[model samples]
Target chain A: MNINLTPGPSQLFYTVPDHARHAFKEGITSISHRSKTFESYFQKATEGLKELLGIPTDYFIFFTGSATEVWEKSIQNLVENSSMHLVNGAFSNRYFEIAKQLGKHAQKMDAPLGQNFSSIPITNYGTELIAITQNETSTGVSLTNDFIREVREKNSEALIVVDAVSSMPYPALDYSQIDSVFFSVQKGFGMPAGLGVWAVNPRCIEKAESLLARGISIGSYHNLPTLLLNALKNQTTETPNVLGIYLLSCVVEDFLRIGIKKIRQETDYKAAILYQALRAHPLMSAFVKDESAQSKTVIVADCGEHSIRISNYLSEHGFNPGEGYGEKKKSQLRFANFPAHSKEQYERMVDLIENLR
Target chain B: MNINLTPGPSQLFYTVPDHARHAFKEGITSISHRSKTFESYFQKATEGLKELLGIPTDYFIFFTGSATEVWEKSIQNLVENSSMHLVNGAFSNRYFEIAKQLGKHAQKMDAPLGQNFSSIPITNYGTELIAITQNETSTGVSLTNDFIREVREKNSEALIVVDAVSSMPYPALDYSQIDSVFFSVQKGFGMPAGLGVWAVNPRCIEKAESLLARGISIGSYHNLPTLLLNALKNQTTETPNVLGIYLLSCVVEDFLRIGIKKIRQETDYKAAILYQALRAHPLMSAFVKDESAQSKTVIVADCGEHSIRISNYLSEHGFNPGEGYGEKKKSQLRFANFPAHSKEQYERMVDLIENLR
Candidate 1:
């Protein structure tokens, strides 16, 4: 009876296809990790993912345990020297912290928490990588493509690694300017979590291999060259999440059927409806200043009271909103509209929020 | 179709339960990850796992995306340099490699790759932590409790960490003497890959907290302390593989109903069947020298010819034996007998191998 508006294990308010269920029950449960059927399934999912994301042919897609694993991989594979990081929110700051912990030469361009990612600072040419959080799930602030391009322009030699965990497929991705992009299946993919989707361009792949050749042992599981070889065939070197990969295939088929542009439009309409409802509310204010920079996927707002009160108020009535992540613990709440959420569900949520106010 | 005999993601070869299908379809897809019902499912699964494993009250059970995550967490929180590691095979060797990769001080007690893990060399216990792999899946070896007790007696201050990845309920664990144990659901748990089961003793928790109290960041998402807090409520900090988690619950129920001893008996019989078949062939010899070290889960053998040829030969028919891992490339092939394999299936596999030979 509870409505999940929390981000990430966001919500699947719609019916999962019967074919996916059948595959999980009849096919995946007993299949060995070494079987060809699983190999094909794993490969197809990765290929489908690459196609859906508009990644180039040179880009290889890998499946890992979590997007958080990508953080370690990024630190291990990239960032040999000082790197510039755009830290506008929680996940971004986390990346900076991870880089520091790995003893990587790294620096952060800090934007205030819960604010739009404005101008990124210039870095020295020796910076081997430039990192950013594309969709700041904690604050609902998204860094536009233009901002990324500017950073790329400033640091041409440095590889660009983007944590696109929350804002993929919906707005569609333009990987032409990026080196590597990573996400988990939970958010925009409308599937359960556990698997990380990584698309690495040939340049990034070569860079990772070069790092490996330098005798830097980037933990066996996250080893990019090993991952690339398996990813080429759409398989993981270690045991993979078979059911999740199968379900993601179903989701990919649905995406191709509906088309990404149509899905984006539909999602836009849903976001508009929710935003209109929020604007009408006297007690709430959007956390991000500009609507353009705000994420269409998640709605972060100051409840004009502590987030716990508003979150509790919403939860008591069956709707659960996102809690403030990072430092904005008390005053902010978030609402996520994932791929599977319906117009009716959005309406129900708004009505519930209105009643709470 | 191809039969999966990879030990894990091992072959399911049977139909999944009906209630699980119903739950996935009509019951729990859209339920909030934080909802009471969803929490109940998660909470019940953890409790069920603890009961199913006969875990002590003092032990804490948690969930992670993969057993690999457990590997990183074990190092991040548990080991503090001076830890002794027993490396009997490829999988066991990787643990110390990961520890070294993470800048932890770990010493290895090396056993020949295909030999049984005899005992831990106690003299090198510079740290208060000791790790052992329970079942070396790569070499088809299992370590006995007597070996564990011998190690414990040598280093009483050291916490014992066991990677029970390939030897969970199927072999029946006696955690009464162990501090922490980890396994993946993909193996003997009879579920799809993705979800990992982590159980830690109270002493390990205290040690983790003490380490955390210092400036050591256990990396976000994989942090053991935060993971345990969520585990107490049967929840994870990030999105979990809901489908895999649910399937694991069904698997636990089935395992408990069947009884651990009966399951072990069944797996043993299947292993014996495969071994007898292998012994009859002139072109084949058991991979490991010690028959006692041969795992009930998988039977590793020398195909006498190239392993790839034998693997391809068996796979051309209905049989799918696992490939040689790491440096054991040309000589070995592994025959896996998970609990799900039927007796008829085993006989058919033996027949196919005999015919192929």
Candidate 2:
């Protein structure tokens, strides 16, 4: 059997194939988005997500095309003039760029690759929104919960938007401190790569409405108000990825049955195995030097000049790993330790890494 | 088995289940979007669409969230100041609304709901783009190819965009006259929803670039330039509906193997049977009064006050007909006659409609 370790569309949960088969048998793909059947699927997914993530009752869940789309949507709906981003890696930087492209005054506080901020940066500019990525998928640098709280405390008037793209359900975020959080199902959710889930509080909604009321263009269809209107009926603003939503609901159900506590424990166990192997290996080292800042979900290793060879070696052994993203493609090897990836798989992978010449 | 006759997200083509099962076994869902496997899927879908739909070499195919999205994208990219639309029904009206929402000066010439125009309306406005819906899903009104040719003849400089949302491959459009065309895969393609295919000629590209050079906000992330740059690499602007693209490729291959000519013939046969039954039934009449303007793909029937009763009767017989859209819900029933739907099934449905007391 082939083992997948690539990030984002990384690994399928053990329950996906079976659930997909059941979906096909139940004619899930052929159902109308307006039908009651689809509404039930929508409700199950939203409720399952709320239960699994411990989301507060005041937060509303919405679905979009992808997390990338969410970046654009958030900028269009929430920011009328300016937004600030805490950028360290490729994904976070893209969010800042999206704001600039949408004609917003976007400012960023940058950290070098493989390093993360321990505290929120002070910005003198007036900002309508502040964006943060909890885990930098490209560099495996993670921001702590405390750092997020600090950011919230520092910028009380600005809406705080969190990108939990590569790390969610793993990070037990305090919903009361966050204004909005978004994620694509492909990464931490261990599902296919289509649907994006955005959980927004009343403040974000009010911000969007304020922009609309002031005659600022907050997009057309699938904007925050339209999404909220459809979501009230357990529907979407557009015809969505129905199959992807169904699979996500099934996977979240599986995650709930396995228990978040147990999943978090397994994640810690797997990360320890890989990090320990990195420390012991002669040719490899953890890319993130700060242990506290290292991402538990995605582990990046600096392999000097042997990154390609090691990735090839792992691939030959029925293990598929991600190469470094963007500029680091030749110098790093990334491994994803999602729920679908068991402790035994990580142990086997670590054994292979440690034995590499 | 239930027969799905909804306009979109309707019936699955027979080959989809087997292909989907194969996709699961091959680990298609777990592959990264940046990986070679995903690139191959993108190339196959693009090539298969070209072969099946007779798309010219000069056109570029791009994917988005839904056909509704293409409306917004087309307006954002191609229209600088104003656009004019040929509006007859709900879907076409939406395209006009999208343009207006994006701060464009949009104007429309309306025909009565169930009628078609034999000639293009003369617009004195210096329109940058002209939008046309070849088949209006809401009213089952189809513009003839000759009518489209007339519109092209009238507006030589304005970009011509055709919405082939519910009718494609069957329409056999003259590509030389159109600047852009878009469709959602769930309708005529008989796949799941969430994937929109936009085919653009070079004129549309140049228009977008011209707007960008002038410092206009042509939107961000999935704008025309970004989409074109990625299409050259067999990739997308974002993590797209990967599974939907894969299924569309498989279904297009099936269509190519079965031959478009044969599929068109079968579609015609199925439509003729349903239209004839509507003509004969005591309680039913063709919703589109003009036989020449009626859509062959989606057949809408005015069931007077018995719309719900007939819909229930059909559903009890394992046939799920689409309820009327918007305000017409109690007065109409819509039947889809795509390739996935067989002639025998249409005949059976027609017989039941005629025998209803």
Candidate 3:
């Protein structure tokens, strides 16, 4: 048996194959998107997500192709001229670039690799949107809840969009502090890649409508108004990833049954074990030196020149650790500690790291 | 045990369950998108599609959220100002609406519902694109290949775009005459929804680049150039529906093994039998008056006020025929003749329709 330790598209929860089998047996894959069955499935998913994430009553949930698409969609719908981004890694930087590519005046405050902002930056850039990635999968650096709250305090007028791509459920985010949060199911949700879930409060919706009323092209189909119109009827603007949505509902149900508090406890335990092992290892060290800034979901280690050998050792023993993102591909080994990844699996991983010579 | 005759999200091919089981067993769902395994899957799907569809070397294939999305992408990338649409049904009308929604000058030549154009319109409106739907799923009307060829002849300078959503592979389109063609996997391809395949020739690419150089927002992340840049490396712009892509490759392989010619032959035979039965029935008649223009893929019948009764009878007996789209819901019934629907199934459906009181 093989274990997937990559950040996104990580290991599937133990119940996934069985759920998929049930879905197929019920003709879930062959049903029409306009059917009552699909509507029930959509309802279950949206409600389950709201229950599990503690999403506000005023927030609306929408699905897109990927979290990357949300980067474009959020900018298109919310920002008419300018946006501000706080960048600490590759994924955050991509959001900034998307804003710029759409002809928005995008300004960014950056932090060095393996480090996170010590405090929220005060800016007078006249930005309409403020983008933040809660967890940087590239460097395994995450912002604390207090940091996000501070940012919100400083920029109360600008819409705050959070990228919770690799750090969700475990983050314990107060949704009341942000305007929008988006994540792909492949990451912490431990499902297949393809579906992006975006939760936005009424403020974002009002912004989109205001822009549309002013003759700014927010987008065409699948834009905020279109998605909202269909969503009110428990449908989508187009034929969405029905199977992905169904599976996500099932997974979220499982997570809720297990309880989020217990999941967070398990996550903290796993992160402590893995980080301790990395710090004590002879040839490896934790990439993020500040313990408070390091991500609990995606743990990265600075392997220096032994990245390949260490990854090979883990793979040979049935663990498939992910390489660093972009330029750090050869210098770091990243391990995902998603809800689907058991504590026993983390122990096995730590054993391998401890025995590495 | 149920027969799915609804146009899209219709029926899963018999091999799909077994293929999905194999996918689960092989851990295909948990693999990373950046891994070599994913690249191989991408390569296989693209190559399998090319071989099965006889797509030319100059045409580039890209995947999107849905065919509805391609309607927007094609217009965004290929047209700068104006587009002319040949509208006969709901799907065709939707394309024209999308173009108008994107702030383009969209013009249309309309035909009454359940009717098709007798001749291509002569236009010198300086249209940048001419859009046509080979098979309109909503009205069950299809344009002949001769009609498409005639349109190409009338407007040589305008890019020809075809929506082959419900009629792919069976139509055996001559790609040399068209600049771009797009389809969703749920219809003729007999897979789950959420994947849109867009194949564009080099001319379409050049058009997109020219628009981009002129500072048009053709889109940001999933724009043509960004998609092409990743396609060159056997990847997508974002974390795509990986399982959907894998399943499509498998289905295309199945088609190649059985041969497209044989599939087309079976489709023709089944359509003939169904249409004959509808013509002979006392309570039902063919919806499209013109025999030459009726679609072989989606066969529609005017059941008058007995539409629900016939559909109910079929559903109670294990077949689920589709209701008419939009305004025709009370008067018509639609049946799909995809590769997944066997000759035996079609015969069974015909027998039921003929004996209905």
Candidate 4:
């Protein structure tokens, strides 16, 4: 069997195939979104998420089409006049651009590729929200929890949102420090690409309500207020990805069974081995030079022009660690260390990397 | 043994379980959205839809989170000042509400509950687009083909949009008369909820470009320009509902194999029997008074107070024709006569209705 190590939509969670089969057999996909059956699925998924993530009591979890959508929704609902973005990679920069496209006065502090946002100070300057991509999927760089907390300390007035797309279940974030955090299930949750989970605190709702009070349009249908309204009733504003939500609930429950702390420990151990392999390689090294900023979930390595050859060679051995993203297509390789990936698999990946010619 | 005839997410196409199993086995769900594997799924689904619907060459097919989303996207990209809506049911009225929420001067001609838009005379005064819900799923009401065609003729300068959410593959709409049309997979397509297919002509593109030229915010990431840009490359603006898209391609191909003509003929046959049963029933009659206004796909009956009991009784025999929508919960019952619902099954439904206590 081919081991899919590509980031986001990587390896299916070990339980997914069984859960999906069960879902289909049970006619879970055939049930109406307005039905009590769907509400149970919604409640299970959202509650499982809150428990798994250690989310605060006042926070609300909402589902979206994809995590990329959360970027737009967050901007529309939270930011009335302006927002600030900490852009270190392609995905992070796109969020900033989305804010501008939405006609918000979006500002940004950029970092070099394969670098972290630890260097950037949070100078909010009247920005309604501060967007930080906690883990940059494109470059496999991440800001430390300490840096994120510092950002909150510096701009406690601005609503802080984190894009933990590629590194959820691995980040033990203090929700008390951030107003909102969003991620897609295709990544860390080990499901197919579809559902995006957005956790927002009461402050985010107050902001959206304030915008509504001022007659400023937040958005249509999926604005924060609308999503929260339906979420409270154990329903979505629109028909959601029922299959995805079902799978996510199953997987999150599986994670709960295994415990989040154990998952994080395993991820850390796996990332350490992979990075050691990259460091010992003859022609490659970990992309993020700063050890503190290196991602434990999505590990990127600089392989220069040999990236394609390395990817092909690895593919021959039934391993696919994904090709480079963005402009680094020929110069980097990414290997996702999701929960679905076994410890044995990462060891094999490390062995393959260390022995590469 | 449950025969789900709920309007959307009702009956899964016969081949769905097998196709889903095959997709899972083939690692379709695990494939990256940027991969060639995904592009193939996108191409097959889109091209198959075009052929099955007899969509023209100039029109591009794009996917969204749900059919509800196309409403917001259509308004955000196409309308600058005003758009006219033919609101008959809940879904149709919501589209008009979306436009107004987006700060557009949206106008509408209202139709009575369970009624058609035949009475709406297209008085387009500086309206950029004319929106029509070809089949309003909520009340099982439909606008006639002639009325939609007349709309285009009356407002030749305005873009004509048809929300064919529950009637696609049945409505052999003359694409030349409309600039855009949209639907979700779960409804008439007989797939699970998630993916929404939108067909837009080149004129819609021109209108979007014109709006863009004037610096109008036509939405972010999912704006027509961005969607079309990625769609041309057999991709979506973000990581879309991958499984939904895959299943769509499979189901659309299945539709093509059976032939859309045959599907439509069967639907017509099924609807006739259901409507006849409703007419002959003691406690129920067809909701739409005018036969021409009644929907062939989603059949609604005026069950008055016996709706729930009738629904539960049907469920005891393993048939679940959906209950009433919106305010008519106790007064009406809806039966979805989709392509997946066999003629024999509909006959059984009719016989059951005849013998109901």
Arrange candidates, best lDDT first: 3, 4, 2, 1
Tens-place lDDT digits, model 2, residues A1-357: 698898878788888889989988898998888889899989999999999999887789999899998999999999989999999799999999999998899999988788997544565446889998989999999988788787778788989899999887798998878899999888788777888999999999999999899988788887899899999999987788899888888888899999999999999999998999888888989999999999999999998799978988999998988889888889998898898898888888888888887
**TM-score against native, each model:** 0.83, 0.98, 0.99, 0.98
After TM-score superposition, what is the CA distance of residue B302 in candidate 4 from its true location, in Å? 1.0
Worst 10 residues of 1 chain B by lDDT: B11-20
Question: Cα lDDT for residue A330, model 3?
Answer: 95
What docking grade applies to model 3? high
Compute the lDDT of residue A92 as modeled in candidate 4.
Answer: 92
- Can you write out model 3's per-residue Cα lDDT over B121-185, one digit (the tens) per residue? 55554689999999999999998877888788878899999999999878888787889899999
Using DockQ as the measure, name the better of candidate 1 and candidate 3.
3
Model 4 agreement with the true structure over B5-101: per-residue lDDT tens digits: 8888779988999999998888888888888889999999999988999999778999999888899999988999999888888989999999999
**Candidate 4 segments exceeding 4 Å error:** A118-124, B119-122
Question: For each model, chain A TM-score?
Answer: 0.93, 0.98, 0.98, 0.98
TM-score, B chain, candidate 1? 0.92
Write the number of the candidate with greater DockQ, choosing between 1 and 4.
4
Comparing 1 and 4 by lDDT, which wins? 4
Residue B80's lDDT in candidate 4 = 92
TM-score-better candidate, 1 vs 3:
3
- Count of backbone collisions in candidate 4: 0
| Residue A23, model 1, lDDT | 72
